[model samples]
Target: MHPPSVRSERLVSPTGRGYLQLESHPAGCFRGVELMRAQVPAPDAPPARRPTALVIGSSAGYGLASTITGLVRYGIDGVGIGWERAAGQRSASAGWYRTIAAATIARDLRSNFVFRNADAFADSTKSETLDLLEERFGGVDYLIYSVAAPRRTDPRTGITHQSVLKPLGEPHTTRNLEFADDGTALLRDVTVEPATEAEKAATVRVMGGEDWSRWVTALAGRGLLRDGFRTVALSYIGSPLTSAIYRAGTIGAAKEHLESTAVTLDALLAGFGGRALVSVNGAVISQALTAVPGIPLYVCLLRGVLGDRFPSPVEQSLQLWEQLTADRPDVDERGRIRLDRWELSAAVQATMAERWRSVTPATLTELADVPWFRTQFRALYGFDVPGVDYAVPVATDLPWPGSPAR
Candidate 1:
């Protein structure tokens, strides 16, 4: 049968300052997934028994990379849960296309991959996922939580919490990257005011470890946690350069709660021969990070300093998998996996700091890889991907191969 076809156009944000692209290219998304799959190295040997993994928020960025690594590198079967919109008059979200591409690729590789397009914060979604785990996979060997939502509704309270990107105490003023309507990257000083007490609490409510803890507790309570089951939540700790607005900011407060929850869950899982951990990942271009005040500038500078040594999201995910599966996982004193070691290296920091200190609007391109940064951001929405002809028409309403029929 002929492949589905629909004329999809490229759409960017009307304001140009916004990070979210209006539409995604299907062919580009598929090619991007293929490229990521190719980066996952094969396991050293076949496993004694096949494992199953479930990746919450697994349609994009680190979550998607982790899902691809689980299936492509370790030969695992898995389920990926993501909240994405279907195509209507415009097009489906980039995540929607990515999940479909991932599922299609997994099937080609003979892996049983399931994709659920629903709000993961809902109790109903949790129950459905649990049923799938019990019926299809028997239980989950790995649980990877990498959610990055701006807001979340509390299933029990029926209240919605929106996360903000502001410092906790005083207002933070920093250099930020802004894009012009003509696609020029400009350096501007942006000041972000401190979040209110209620906002901080709400940020924690939306982005903190509460949901992760809930998910783990629910799984264990349902008798679905297998022996040696491992669960990890993705976190980040950037350099002191962006600390005021990032690592020491409102989001950082939420991450602190998340890390603490890992410690608590670790103790709870010990009885089942399981463990919980938080993996502090490296700085990589992602849709969520693009919206943060100071991260784009920091990441662009870091990329310029690291150059070829910079680790992509997929590369970091592979490293994370290796660390998690090791007999004695390498962790810091706080028992958190350090995937940001390279990005946080003293040499890298020094170089990036020097560049940051000297960088100006005129020298921005010379000091940082702004072009590459822009390309990466565009690629997140399935544009500028290599080996894809965006000029040709492609399908936008592609069905997710792993989703059950209506």
Candidate 2:
């Protein structure tokens, strides 16, 4: 019997093995991807063939931020896959507020962007992506996987992998965080859940290496990758205090699988001279990370550290773009990209670990926001609303940074 990973709908590509097209919601009467598709290249734009890229989970948090960075920093016209209404409340499927915010920002810059609402984890979504690549652009040079979800059933095996965030092998209690209606100060309470072996496996199955491999294999089969084409996925290594709930816990197993997949993918793509990387990114409040076992406390702690100097998902994404398409090499010794390298430095970790030893639920806010950590947390979800006119009723119908002409 096939493992639970491969048993899905066997996403097939009837269209050329490239991108996917989405059902345009015309009745909404909103201008979105259409406006962003036609802007001419700026005179001072970097010299090169127009690079094409695709970012899955491109609605909120790191996903959305990365899409904007790709457009504003690099000239890579790309497609964004996520479930966001053009305007509405922030849903787990798609945070329309962030979508609109990103769209508004993209418009101000006259970018080429397209948003496709799809469940990126599914075989159907893969097929749709293939269609989009074929019809929209000839192919893609880069693919970014930043999906965050709970469960996935292998279409082939019908085995469902359900994700969980709990302490491993211990009945640990964590403070449950609840934000007030005004999104001001957070309230905390003790919460308990013992992560079982099944939960660990489920987390790995849902967030681990298999689907990523599938994506690369499918794309390579269709000739979507360009010369020296690249792919990247994000990972994290938090302080030891949260390690039990993060890297060493259920999600850690998934990351272990994911990191290992990079090497496997390198071998698989050896013929194409393409490469895959696992970027060790800093912690940020994407919809996905918000619900993790120990993330809220960690986020609060890390936010207190970075202060204004920290990087937002948008900024981190721009840095990531520079690493991919630019001549820059900002990777660490391990050849993996490191966005939170400095902030998570040996000195910082040592300090934070020491601080965590004495930290309690009462002191979370006080200790979470060191100058370095503060900036990092603020950068997670674009919460530090800058000079942008938040008062003005903004709309998400802005230019996409890297979308192709329809």
Top-TM-score structure, candidate number: 1
TM-score of each: 0.96, 0.75
The digit string of per-residue lDDT tens for model 2 on 258-277 reads: 98998899777667777788
Residue range 1-406, candidate 1, lDDT tens digits: 1224435444433222457567877777888888998898877888777788989999999999998888888877868899998878667788988887888778777887788998999999999999988999888889999999999999999999999999878998999887877788988898999999999999999899999999999999899899998999999988899998787888999999999999999999999888899999999899888888878999888878878888888899998998878877899999999999998889889988898889999889888988899888888888888887666767677665554432
Off by over 4 Å in 1: 1-3, 6-17, 403-406
Taking all chains together, the TM-score of candidate 1 against the true structure is 0.96
lDDT of each: 0.86, 0.62
Distance from true location, Cα of 347 in model 2, Å = 2.2
Clash tally, candidates in order = 0, 48
